[model samples]
Target: MLTPYLAMFLDGRGLNSVEIGQLLALITLTRILGPNLWANLADRSGKSLRILQIGAALALASFFVIFIADGFWGLTLCFGLIMMFWTAIMPQMEVITLNSVAGDAHKYSRIRLWGSLGFILLTISAGRLIDWFGTEVLLVICLALLAALLLVSTRLREPEQLPDNSPHTGSIWSKLKSPVFLGFILALCLLQVGFGPYNSFFTLFMKDLGYSGMQTGLLLSLGVLAEILIFLKAGRLIQRFGIKWMLLISLALTVVRWALLAHFAHLPWVLIATQCIHAASFGLTHATAIQFIHRYFGRRYQSRGQALYVSLAGGLGGAVGNFGAGLLWQQGQGATQAFLAAAMVVGVSLVVILLIPSRHLECASEPAR
Candidate 1:
């Protein structure tokens, strides 16, 4: 709901395209700062569910103030507070979910597809709601969802503590210091940087292309539909091609997806094809990343590992992507250039992913459970 519509919503609130992009950059920046804070707390306390519930409750409280925020500063401050708390929820949640499934990639994908389903349903209906009522409805919808998150968090029980007896029991810094892990984090950060333009502007870009709110939502939904399917097959794909190869494939497809969108977005059919590859671009890439990180870090440091991914990859990379996309966008006139830049960044990440040392590969040969 937030990703596809926030640009449109801020536009309705009288913000310019560039301002909207900057606001998004700030929001993503919170992902960098917020998660690290919560991750440390959760790791120390050993209560991931409690951290998530607190984050959700705070995020909802902060977002409610959006109703009274009047100008750029007000809007920025309001959203910053909301996202600061909101970004903290997911990393902890990922740790909990992976623990529940015993790190089974296939089972994890099955559970995660429900989120994609929610994205599809909400994106489809939000567009219709916007077409009928207006973008202000975004606030109400977001508030309600945040409330639901808080409620759900309260209901969830943390997985039972398991004895982590694996050999590598060094400090968190030792795990962070590994060359392969560094490469993985850097590559993910760059890939996310590449994602900046599409994520921050695709909805607005669709509008500029003369697509209706409903069509824009459908286009976004179509990408997620593909994402859901990829997620369903994630385990098999990992078992067949292995995680390393699948990472490269996802990045290469993303490069193609963006380049095609840059040149052929006006071609509605081309748009559909690009959206279809979102499965590879986002779904597969994310699934593999989660599995890789789960296997890479020891159980004691799981929350921290997930937090670092969100903070560095999603937060830092997203900040650059959102901000740079704003500048390249030049108020929609430079959409093509913005997208091409994104493609090039992802291409760089493709090379970076190759830096993963062969010694640490878990799924390169053996079948994933």
Candidate 2:
């Protein structure tokens, strides 16, 4: 919801593409340290739920400051503070969610699918609302959602029993040193780098093509709706195809998706079709990656492993992508080039995915019933 409108909000404030990209990059930059810092504290204290609640509270407070922020630096500082806490929320929640479901990692998709639903709901409504009211409504809606998140956070309880019998048998460092794990992280980073253009500017791209805010929102929602469908069936797909093939397929689709967006964005149907690829590009890949992280890092290092994943793949990777996309985007012909460059980046990710050992791609173990 907030995501699909954030770039637009920045634009409405008279910021240029470069400034908006810089602000987005700054948000990702903090993810490099914020998640790890919070996760370490949570892991040491065995208080993930409490940590998440604190982060949520801080995030809400920091975001409210955005209402008063003026000028580039002020908005940047406020958004940065908001993201510092915001990034802390997801990785810790991933740990808690995985723990609560026990060994059935597949069940994660079912639980997480609700998030996709919420995103779709908010995104579509926000788009229409912005169309009716104005971009200023973004702040109010964001505040409302964050407040709801804060309220929800208070109700979440920590998982009582953590998973045992994780397949990996080495220290976190040793596992990180493994070729498969290293390759996987590298692939994830490249994939995120590819996502930079789409995440930062896709809505703007639609707007440039003369699409309304509601249209842009619907398109974005369409992608997540596809993602939700994939989530419902992700477990069975993983069982059949294995994580390696799933990732390979996703990366391959991402390349095509970006290419389509670059060359055929003027065609409404073409745009709609391309958006559906989000099912594989994000939905399957994310679910598979989470399970892989669980398997690779095991229980002892779960929180930190999730932190590192968010930091490297989502943080550094996204920062590079956003920064590069900003540099590439021009008044005209720039969006095309930016998206093409994105496709090329994900192409590299595909190669990295192929480099992982075949055995590593297979399911490590059946989910405990």
lDDT of each: 0.86, 0.86
List ranges where model 2 is wrong by over 4 Å: 363-369
RMSD of 1: 1.8
Write the residue-wise lDDT of candidate 1 on 211-306 in tens digits.
888999899999999999999999789877787789889999999999998898899899999999999989998999888877767678888889
Clash pairs (backbone) in predicted model 1? none
Model 2 reaches what TM-score against the true structure? Answer: 0.96
Clashes in each model (backbone N, CA, C under 3 Å)?
0, 0
Worst 10 residues of 2 by lDDT: 360-369
